[model samples]
Target: MTTLRIILGDQLSTTISSLHDIDKHNDLILMCEVNEEAQYVKHHKKKIAFIFSAMRHFAEGLKKKKYNLLYTKLTDKENTGSFKGEVKKTIRQHHINHIIITHPGEHRVLEDIQSWETDLNVSLEIREDNRFICSTDEFTKWVKNRKQPRMEHFYRHMRKQKTVLMDDDKPIGGKWNYDTDNRKPPKSNLTIPKPCSQKPDQITKEVISLVNEKFKDHLGELDGFDLAITRDQALKALENFLSKRMPSFGDYQDAMLEGEPWMYHSHISTYLNAGLLLPMECVKAAEDAYLNGSAPMNAAEGFIRQILGWREYIRGIYWLKMPGYADMNFFNATRPLPSFYWTAKTDMNCLKQSISETKKNAYAHHIQRLMILGNFALLTGIDPKQVSEWFLIVYTDAYEWVELPNVYGMALFADGGYLASKPYAAGGSYINKMSNYCKNCEYNVKKKTGADACPFNYLYWNFLAKNKKKLEKNHRLAMMYSTYERMDEKTKKQIKNDSLQFLENLT
Candidate 1:
């Protein structure tokens, strides 16, 4: 039987499950750059270029292995602009009767593909994606009877199951997490190692031009596009991080500097999420560095926890609660996102730096994403859907399965503590302690409620007062609520008025 094997843009791995037991001589490989996926959320121009370039490179490698392949470029005049349209045309043209595909990263894409068997009147096989250490069915089993599926508990299960950083059965160094030791603030004279960069080759350059022409109005710039487009380059990037930056990655993982965007960061999420690098490979590289005395145990454990713990746990929660999870609005926030998020025209130095860096590199470290940009949206009551969509659009590594839970549950607390123990809301003091943006900010971080006061100070208090009914009983936020309650009535009124005025004039 003639079969058509389909590959999604993010499924660029050669070991992807859909390619298993393939009859390379008779089976046809199909890859397409369709407008429906690219423009689904007005994705960053660099994001589009990276996926297309990587897809082209992956297709070339398959062609060299003598596989019969059908590829569609975005610029083709006959492009149908949607996956269904392209697949229908291909099935009719090739006289194919069977189709096989790896599961997609996004839930919506998976739903569409599930409908294809009936819609096209062909047998379709959607193989399980084994790229992750924990499969969806496995995660569902893990969380089946638990009241709260905490990441820390799930992380320990993963470590034990994968045997990562384990000494026989117990965790190495007698601890499963090093997050506490990883929270040091940045030093004034901190010396950061430079991350590895790959210049665009002919294929990547062609893809860049294509993105610039077609997505001129997209969210990000295409210049300085230095991501790895293949597995070889991605492996090199992993090696560079291990040798040069892994020693101090734990210490400064949460620190943000004024002009430093990639400070001690791996910058490998784009490659990892794109399937150029496997999560276990990166984990083992860090573990090897620790075993050889090149990197500390804290650094290795910290990095591993992100992938083996948080990344896996979030994916599980996304699959478990999705289709209903997307509509969660715990605080009923309905405010529109301000124009400054796109333009980076805010007087708040923290927001300006984070957004500007995001536009330039299509990346921001975890701290910048959570404490700075995400914190502002949470404090200001911007719609969680708008915040989630913004994150999905602007980042090179963002997909709905990962980005939605982070934005809605962890960032916005829109899921009411499903994904996080508490809302990550903070005032300017937290930013002042961890980052240098406060030094140059026009709004004073010290002032609490006045014309020159930092917006976060009053907004933080205002958020607490506004949500007292829903959040007051939670033990994690009891201390914050007590402080709010102790403040004099007159002082509380001043803070509320000032926060209201600041939010009113935000646009």
Candidate 2:
């Protein structure tokens, strides 16, 4: 009756039901650091350090609870650097007859495990990942016959089903979304909330050294990295957000400021993505803050939607259409990502700031991701797969399942109208409206066709022109084209020429 349990880095949940009834004497738990995961993309140094440190911390916690454990450090010399290789070696050494695992976050990893079952003569059983509020089956049931799986509709249903922010089974404040109230532009005198940070412990310091030695060529800085790795530390991060930050989260969640890394952001995504903090716990914490009159309803509801609505909905969409989902490219874009994306050396002030911050901290708020980097990629027609891979690697909060849908589907609109009704293509005005980065830009945000014209303006029109045949059928996109039709031919030709010049320089 010998068994082995495999725990992936992202599946470090202590409450996972897979570990419920432990025959610890007969069963061994296996955890490994695989290069296949890191090499999938050139991940930021901070991201690599974070996952490794968190995994090591979780392993230590499990040992303190007296579980039979087999953990691999990144520096383990004999490691084969692949999950299957490590698992096979463990099975032979331990004489394990069966292996149990929680379902992986990505389908590729799941398929890899499935491919090995017949050869090993061992049963590989995968339990559900219960950290999510809704199960895959539940989401599938909700989308059974729907022609389109729009997230807002699904979000409303989730609200009703879970009774989150409900009054007598009806939505509180009589509205399904308070998004309109959450989009205020940043003002000159706004008071910014201080971000939460956990001081590095001995284990995290070792992980930093491991990353420095092993991944010296990676993209980001390792010197300024510090994140919560333990449950108590994670709880404190949650508390600080509730008490100090959540009240202003809605006011400026969409607004970007200069020299500010965290303006009313929770900074809890790292913990939540790492399994150190559960999403439901965060949702409840926000709800309690609203109920106690410690935070405004707009801020509470907005923060809750990001978790219970957006985070949950994206996970469902990712699982529903994957394996082939990564290849979706509606625009047929073949361009490589601009070199400035990696270097952060551009005259466009917004992009420069966002990318420099990404290089510094290996983190950016959701708006920065969607609007700055993702927007530029979408408008410029960069390869969807490359853009998606960049997103998967750059951030500490990224895992394939969460990162893919947001990057490919929501941000890039590469899913060809599956996750969104239309591409979120926009002219420079949208960026100007959202942030102060445009104020200091060399290119004028108002102009579209001259040398001093903003790149977003020309590229946006060019994007629409290039993809009109594909997008014309979408009702939401039809009006934009109709407006383009009214523009003089002279102006249209100038936009095309400017766009071509910009594309030429992109490479």
Best by lDDT: 1
lDDT of 1 at 286: 83
Candidate 2 residue lDDT tens string, 1-507: 588988898887888756767687878999999888877778999888888988998999989989999998766887889998898888888887888888889988999889768867788788888899999999999889998989899888988888899997788888878899999988867888677777898999998998898889889878867688787788899999999989999988898887887889998888898788999999988998999999998999999999999999999999999888888887787889888888999999999999999888888998889888988999888898888888887888888899999989988898888898888777888889988888899999999889999899988888888888888888988888999989999999999999998889888
Winning candidate number (TM-score): 1
Pairs that collide, model 1:
none
Which residue pairs overlap in candidate 2's backbone? Answer: none
- Candidate 1 to truth, TM: 0.99
Q: Compose the digit string of candidate 1's lDDT tens values, residues 1-507.
A: 589999999999999999999897899999999999999889999899999999999999999999899999998888999998899999999998999999898999999998889998889999988798899999999998998889999999999998999999999999888889998999999988877989999999999999999999999888888999999999999999988998999999999998999998899898989899999888888888988899999899999999889888888899899989999999999999998889899899999999999999899999999999999999999999999999999999999989999999889999998888889999999999999999999999999989999999999999999999989989999999999989999989999999889888974
Number of colliding residue pairs in each model: 0, 0
Candidate 2 segments whose C-alpha is farther than 4 A from its true place? none
Q: What lDDT does each candidate get?
A: 0.92, 0.87
Model 1 stretches with alpha carbons more than 4 Å out: none
Clashes of 1: 0
What C-alpha lDDT, on a 0 to 100 scale, does residue 316 get in candidate 2? 95
What C-alpha lDDT, on a 0 to 100 scale, does residue 294 get in candidate 1? Answer: 93
